[model samples]
Target: MPPGITTFAADAPTLSAANTGFMLICSALVMVMTPALAFFYGGMVRVKSTLNMLMMSFISLGIVTILWVLYGFSLAFGTDIGSFIGWSSDFAGLSGIGVTQLWDGYTIPVYVFAVFQLMFAVLTPALISGALADRVKFTSWALFITLWVTVVYFPVAHWVWGAGGWLYELGVIDFAGGTAVHINAGAAALGVILVIGKRVGFKKDPMRPHSLPLVMLGAGLLWFGWFGFNAGSWLGNDDGVGAVMFVNTQVATAAAMLAWLGYEKLRHGSFTTLGAASGAVAGLVAITPSGGAVSPLGAIAVGAIAGVLCAMAVGLKYRFGYDDSLDVVGVHLVGGVAGSLLVGLFATGGVQSDAKGLFYGGGLEQLGKQAVGVFAVLAYSLVVSAVLALILDKTIGMRVEEDDEVSGIDQVEHAETAYDFSGAGGGLSTRSTPPGPGTSPAPTNKKVDA
Candidate 1:
């Protein structure tokens, strides 16, 4: 019934209602990723701040959803202006979207496309908060998300996805959001880490993850949700979408997994579940940029390389002393760069006309373009995120009170504890405790008289 459905009715374009329905399901699958992220990051942190960490992911779901509905969709997807960003028309307040309205050439309703894209918008920024974990003020973080989403995320999304945007016009291939999502978030994470300063007792503390099982669960969810992520980019049900993306995802992840375990076995004397999960994610991130463009062989190389690089990068914080907490810089930033660059080198036929990589004799032109795009995003994100972090730090402050952090942010900020094994009354409290409460008991003033 929608306008565009008729365009594909005669030949059953892959972009039919069935494809749209699959994509909608895919969107929901992607939406689950943030909560999965919550669990992933939550388990990686100390138990005391678990809920606060989860709250960060949860808040993104709520805040970014509203922001996208308001104007983000328009900025990212509406008609392009000057090939940088989009110009607003129909999507302000979701103005014209309805069940009868199809989106561009897709058979699904516009609302389906909007919701699927919204999940990506929400998760990208949420990824950065991990770098600033246990340090940021909740209110300030909320404000930062609002601003960063507008400036960094919206424009990048437009450039990559919008019809008239430069990257799209230039024939750069990003099946999903390697440049827009992972690289952008990864760069921003580094900037925030720089501005926020290191967490208290960074090198002095052991700072091991409180629970590994939760981390594994989070990884599983991300893997499942990513099917929607990489595959859904096709926006259709053709064999190209089903076969190419599917095999690329599988082979790349498999190669990355092997690479990670191999590195760990050689270095640490044990292949950890953490390594397995991290490798899988690294592979996923690497494949994301090049999946639609490269051969299965190319994907294996990209993913395996990302796994090794990301694994190496995780140690950079310790060596360089940046204290990126959960290694957002190491995994996302490093892995994203690897993926983006490899795409420039390994892109095969039919993905993009002007932008095949070096392997196919496309020359350095495509590779140069890819490099420019990567650097442009990296520089812009780093500078903007640093400025934002400093402003938030100076205006309202970024770090929690030391005592509150020691006591745990779950109780201090959210008023809820992640665990309730003691069956205590604290679990029943309807209101959250203000940060820096009576926990740890006030130090007695008694002093030894000299």
Candidate 2:
């Protein structure tokens, strides 16, 4: 067993097996968050490309599933090469991992850990697709994800989580993934958006959601699945993990929901359900990194701060002229940063069995370490993602044909629509005129079957 891992020796075998089983369930729970993400993003886009948006998430599920089996797992968690990346020697090629412990000190099945981590790998890049909705070709995104995961995502995951990783050695506390998952995905999303450029007719267009109910449904699922996400980080069921993460998740989400609504009431003159839903997600993202590290009060602060920052960041695209269609950069990138940095100050001792933050009198050194880690992730993700995006854009093209875009991606890309109410008494004849200048209809009703 790992040196610091303490348990009754007589209970070791049973508890370890139970923890493995629990984590398997947890990993499956986390995977559901991606489809949930599909709904959340699908409901926010123009009617023309709703199915296309969901396809982005679906595409990741297939592509990353394959890649994770091939080398994605090894790259992230395999034996360290140089404190920068992992060697591929442990490439089990789907069989390399099993219900056996690989790390020297850990007790859970190595495969359980690998699969749980793989869900995260699959979803992080998918989370970025919200920024370039309705424009990028499906082929381009597929190729881009292939390359980006290899060059950008895998190495960063190694640097943070893998044994002998630099950040892990530096005593940086991720608990979950403020830097690796949320922040890395967020920064990479920004870089790709910049390279891909804005979606057609953004800001001036009235790109309202086609279905508010879908968004709500997605939010509900995410909330349900997140319990596993935050708690599962422990790799086991224990008092410490249950105590800190449960409370942290609850309070942070609540605080963020309230903050987002409060801000909307002040700015837009009404409290919107959309804002409340969005805020809840914002809170979840912010708390992800710090959930296992902080107190209830600290969780509140993190959620409130992230809520305000993301609410403001969503408007940045309009000012800066990038078309992050569903606010990936605004919510994930900004919220990730808020949570990560706050953990530098608010982390209480004993979440991970060691470590505290500057606010708890651990001094400015820990905070500075966090700043370095954050900047490093942002810079690396930005540079690598930009290069990969440009390469894919040049090779097979990125944007769909102009005609296909204007006609709608569902018809052009998927050959189906979400709603097939055609020929109904209240449907065909009531077909409203297509929207015009300064008016973009909500996303077309099209479910992504994948």
Candidate 3:
């Protein structure tokens, strides 16, 4: 029992073996999402850039973990400072804490909560990597992650979920990470891409996913892990709020997948594995922030709307001429916005809190609060992330030389390729060496899986 926790002494919290174990499992599940995203994004890039895409997401796990242990957790979950950031003496470097000590007033130990949230921090920066795939220098991207998390993600998490943080105090209602994770990452992706510019030969080259099977596998794993990601946010399932969130997660994700496939079939003439995977992710993103608040039926509505929205939004990159190599902006950004705003309409007062949504007779007030949280995060992440990217670009250079990009980033940057073709008569590609900039593409059957 630390002095400042200030829980009522009579009903003082005790460590719940059940919840502590549950959260540990949840932390592991959430941690898996970074690699899951790696697989998902890796399969979506051209075979030449696959390893770099995978490494982009994988690197976040290493960088954010050390930072989180040192001070990231304190900045996020520590006591509030002027409603913007947080800090606690004991949380710094995670020192001076007892193993048995519960987090604030929760039944789980402080260590459990810190690690669980650390997984989220790891995943969020990785989410931005997809948009910058193929072109960025690995070192610059790594540095960007280091600085971006420190300046952007930490403070944003504090604002949304930290105790006494402004949004938490004002009741903005992000059950998990609608605004914090998805929107924050999406906006930051847009910002950095703007600074870095489009991938070379953006539209002229027919860039398609290397492997849809890998993408599907990643999506399946993500869906499986998200149950823990959403439900586990409640810290415990004792009161049934976590249970409701679990059900909503399933329903919304299913609805979003179906809806996205339907849109793809009607608009593009065929349903795709890519559509299924992307739709499922759209649903997951949409439900992440609102699952604990919306009814199962409302989850369906939320998923459907978001699925269609993200499907359509993906095309905007082509139309707008931004090279979001993957659809991070469309799926995560648009889906996050829809989900966060939908909370105001779908929330049932009897659920997570006593706040009702518009459809449930709550009126426009909760909607307004949700908007504030949404825009504040979007604006802050976008502006600050762009500035960070710009600074990195001007100083150490963010993108590889255009010739290196044309030759394949993996070979140029990492000195490795996803596949070894030395003994197979240079499988698929004709030239023993990679083609340089403006070189004609190798002859191939156009698979275009995505």
List TM-score per model, in order: 0.89, 0.90, 0.93
Candidate 1 whole-model C-alpha lDDT, 0 to 1: 0.82
lDDT of 3 by residue, 1-450 (tens): 011245788878889999999999999999889899999999999988999999999999999999998999989888889999999889999996789988866789999888889999999999999999889999999999999999999998988888878887788988889999999999999999888999877988788898999999999999988987899998876889999999999999999999999999999999999999999999999999989888899999999999999999999998998888899999999999999999999999988888889998999999999999999999999999999999999999999999888888999888988976545566464566778999887676554322
Candidate 2, superposed: residue stretches over 4 Å from native: 1-15, 97-103, 423-426, 429-450
Which has the higher lDDT value, candidate number 1 or candidate number 2?
A: 1
Q: Please, what are the lDDT tens digits per residue for candidate 1 over residues 1-450? A: 011222445654333667777888889889999999999888888887788888888899989999999999999888778988885678978987766676776656778888889999999998997887776778888888999999999998888778787876766666778888888999999998888888877999778888889999998898888888888877666546445876898889889988998999998999998898889889988898788888889989998999999999999998998989888888888888888888878988665234578998888877777777677778888999889889888988877888787677777788887877435663333324443765554333442211
- Name the weakest run of 10 consecutive residues (lDDT summed) in model 2: 1-10
RMSD per model, one decimal: 6.8, 6.2, 5.5
Cα lDDT listed for each candidate: 0.82, 0.81, 0.90
Model 2 residue 390 CA deviation in Å: 1.0
Instruction: Please estimate how well model 3 matches the true structure, expressed as its whole-model Cα lDDT.
Output: 0.90
Write candidate 2's Cα lDDT for 1-450 as tens digits: 011133565655442667777888889989999999999889877777888999999899999989988888888777788899886565647564444644334556667777788888888889889888889888888888888888888888888777788887786667777889888988998888888787666766677878888888888888877877788887777556755786898899999989998988899899887788889999999998888878899999999999988898889988988888888889988988888888778888767645678889777777777787788999999888988888877878888887787778878878877666656753434436777779656456555322
Best by TM-score: 3
Clashing pairs in 1: 415-432
Relative to the unseen true structure, what is the C-alpha lDDT of residue 94 in candidate 3, on a scale of 0 to 100? 92
